[model samples]
Target: MERKRSNRGRWTSVATAVIWIGTTGGASGHEIKVLASQLLTAPGSRDTVYLSWGHIVPVDMPIDAETIKDYRLHTPSGSVNYLSTEGTSLHANVVTVDEEGLYTAEVIRHPSIYTLVIDETGHRHATGSKVEAAKLGGTVDYSARSHQFAKALLISGDAHEGSTKVLGHEFEIVPLDGPESWVAGSDLRVRVLFQGKPAARQDVFARYIGFKPDQAWCFAIPTDNDGIATIRVDRAGTWIIRAQKTLPAALEDRALFDLESYTASVALEVLP
Candidate 1:
């Protein structure tokens, strides 16, 4: 009975070792990869920067074992220092700098790949991270136009995306030429209203419609002191504009104003 029990125990030990080696070996051998969107320059004033990326961990991948330990951001002059890994994405708080130059972030996965370098610049540079590009550039444009007017209001100026507000209305601009009658490069005015009342201090955006729908020309313009916002339609066409009022911690959708509100397509008619 002792001999039988001993043999059984030996077989169990051997099987356990085999399973451990097979499972651990493959997982330990897995390589670490990095990806990013386009590199960006921090706005001249802001210090905090946001970086986002995606990573794939294969099934059976070790949680704490094969994961990245930290990330380092390097500037043209010197290293900005290392940052700890936050789940899969790497984030860093950049020190404000007055000068411009190249910057790179290197991700370190222990005992595996030397380091995956993500290169970007304070001015402009190349980036190989697809995950980062989509996160940073995945913003929608909100702009529109009103129907034809003998004399339309002119709205102009610039605002950062998602930051500027036009009274209760929020909008993004897309470039489209009206009928052949409308002149290009000339300022065409459109009326903006909210609930039949002239909305004041509204945020307006001007985005140039590029050759493709995916490309946009956008700038934010705040409404005049009187709550009216005017935008120039460089190219004339039907444009979809959005209006909204934002409250603390919430966004109010005010797209549909009163019936008397300006019509959607603000035709840029040629002056007879």
Candidate 2:
């Protein structure tokens, strides 16, 4: 049997842990994010991008390839490339850029049900159905239909013409600034959108690549009425920005779950 890597790691550095926790409001779980080794590359460079589930650590746990409902690469010339990884391990997709413009990689996952139940003995269980867990003498603690969307920004050269365009995600975090704004000590602004409109007062979370795995995020802030959140690019490295929105389940879905969750994450590289 292939041994599974333990998802929980120790907080070896107290100072790092304290700083991250203080800014991020403590660590949480179940974050879906896109993963890439390098985002800024030259033309004809091949980049392998993967999807990780259950944590914001860009390369945490690779999800099953079958879970991907859509994978696409949007180009600066307004062309879209449909990508697939049928024969690859864990369905990781690879892209080779031939143009000198900003490229966006988007991945949409199939919706799934996640449920937590607490039994009489006070033990918690993870199940797929809240109704079934309730019948099994377990009190339903939380249940939701989780929908995840992930994106990564890759710049081939200096052409950043389409860096600020919306890609039509159901729930999205669009970077309003271009690669020029990704410098350390600069303010990188992003807007959250839900159903194609501004998502006001949305909570946005971010962290750099070297952040400890035991921490939740390096920074946390909420968007203003215009749905814009300003994140300080404090370091010159890869960063992941994430946001989530949850709503009550539809009438028909109420029996299966209590709510619906939509999560979005964007990964990019920052220069010093």
Candidate 3:
């Protein structure tokens, strides 16, 4: 049997826990975010990105491991298949860029159910479900998650090459246009797209990670009819933006919480 790597070794970082969108995203329907080594990275450099179920939020215990059915590095020409291994916590894949275009990373975790129960009585549960009536029972029924994340990396000396491309993902967020690099006082414009069109009136969030890895500043804005949400970056650092659509649960489970969520995000850096 293959020795499954511990969740801590999943992403190659100890500080891999993250919680996006304040209290709104309560570990329900999720968005797969790509945390790049650095948003403003040089071309041909070793860039490793992690596919996290939630944002860069601190999560206790080990995150439930879900097999990444489709992990691809997308470009205008086509996509390159990524060999993702199992037993790894967060599916962190590394990519090398030679041509400067729109590099979009797509991560898909097929439907799964994650349940956490306090097992103080030394009862080991094999499944991701609550055992009997354990105190503090939490469940996350994750439907098929299709998350598309894009980062514009124009090398230090090169012109834009590839055209803006979309892989026809369901829940997606595309950086329309803005300054090449964001500063302290800058506004970011992102289109909330669902199935190739704009998603109107949805809540979007941007979590800015400052110099201190332990702290972050969060901002929330709503998308307009055009499916665009503009938010100001008050500080300079790394920003992981996420937005989603929600609906009532198809089948209610009395033991679990209510509702389903679908999310998309931009995992990159904002210059100071």
Candidate 4:
């Protein structure tokens, strides 16, 4: 199939509508996510997928191609297709749908180590090397190796089985039910998985477009022992649900970092 180019003005409008619902898991630092021009579309239509990276909003943050470990599309037919990317300014790619079903756009970022040091003199320094921060004779306020995963859903005609397919991402959020009919005041059932197993007792945060900018999230819920979280769809608009897992570093890695963290997010659209 021939690739399509996304119009800058069209993307600007779609991006403006979903920026309110964008998320980057952690309280500090930038996070990456995938967003589409539209969640619902017709057969033979094209959708522009954006790999957005930023703190809380989906601004035009330029992403280094090397940082993107993987970017692909999972089609309704179960075929995996790699995206031919274009435009680093938005990190955008376009995909076309010829049949009717749901498609998933997924992205994985290379694991990166980050540390924050607060010296005795009350000055803070941020660096990618924890060992370097330790040599400053300062307090390691935060030190963790981060793994990020993101996904966005696009429906061509109707929602289908692809929504529940486990794509084998180290950390992922899977919708238990189809999102084709999600609407305001409804409840969305989702599962958090880590290393192909259910991630039990995890914290999940969610927000919708137009939510309060000062607030971290509009809804906060924890997964049950089965890794299930029932998020109440508060209002109509684009919505994103994110989850994070943090663990103490292994004995060998302790010398380099204090903790390892995994974060995952999924974007959905809810009708009024």
Error of 2 at 222 (Å): 0.6
Candidate 3 lDDT score at position 47: 70
- Tens digit of per-residue lDDT, candidate 2, span 1-272: 11121111112223433565555331123555666667888888888776666653655555666777888888877799887756424456777788888888888988877776777677454547687777777778767788888888887788555346788889999999888778776678999999999999988877787776545566667799999998876668888888888899998989898888888989988889
What shift in Å separates residue 113 of candidate 1 from its native position after superposition?
Answer: 46
Across residues 1-272, which tens digit of lDDT does each residue of candidate 3 receive?
Answer: 12233322322221222334234444443345545565555556667655555434422122334545566666434656564646756656666765554455666556444332334454222233333323444333332212234332222223253223455667777666633535565667778888788999987766665423432225666799999887666556667676767665555443442334466666545567
Misplaced by over 4 Å in model 4 are 1-28, 85-88, 119-125, 134-138, 160-163
Query: Which residue pairs collide in model 3, if any?
Result: 10-89, 17-57, 17-58, 18-56, 18-57, 18-58, 19-57
Clashing pairs in 2: none
Best by lDDT: 4
- Give the TM-score of each candidate: 0.24, 0.84, 0.66, 0.83
Per-residue CA lDDT of model 1 for 79-107, tens digit only, reads: 55554444433343444433344343444
Off by over 4 Å in 2: 1-29, 87-89, 120-127, 135-137
Tell me model 2's lDDT, rounded to 2 decimals.
0.74
Q: Write the candidate numbers in order of decreasing lDDT.
A: 4, 2, 3, 1
Model 1 residue runs over 4 Å out of place are: 1-182, 208-217, 236-238, 248-272
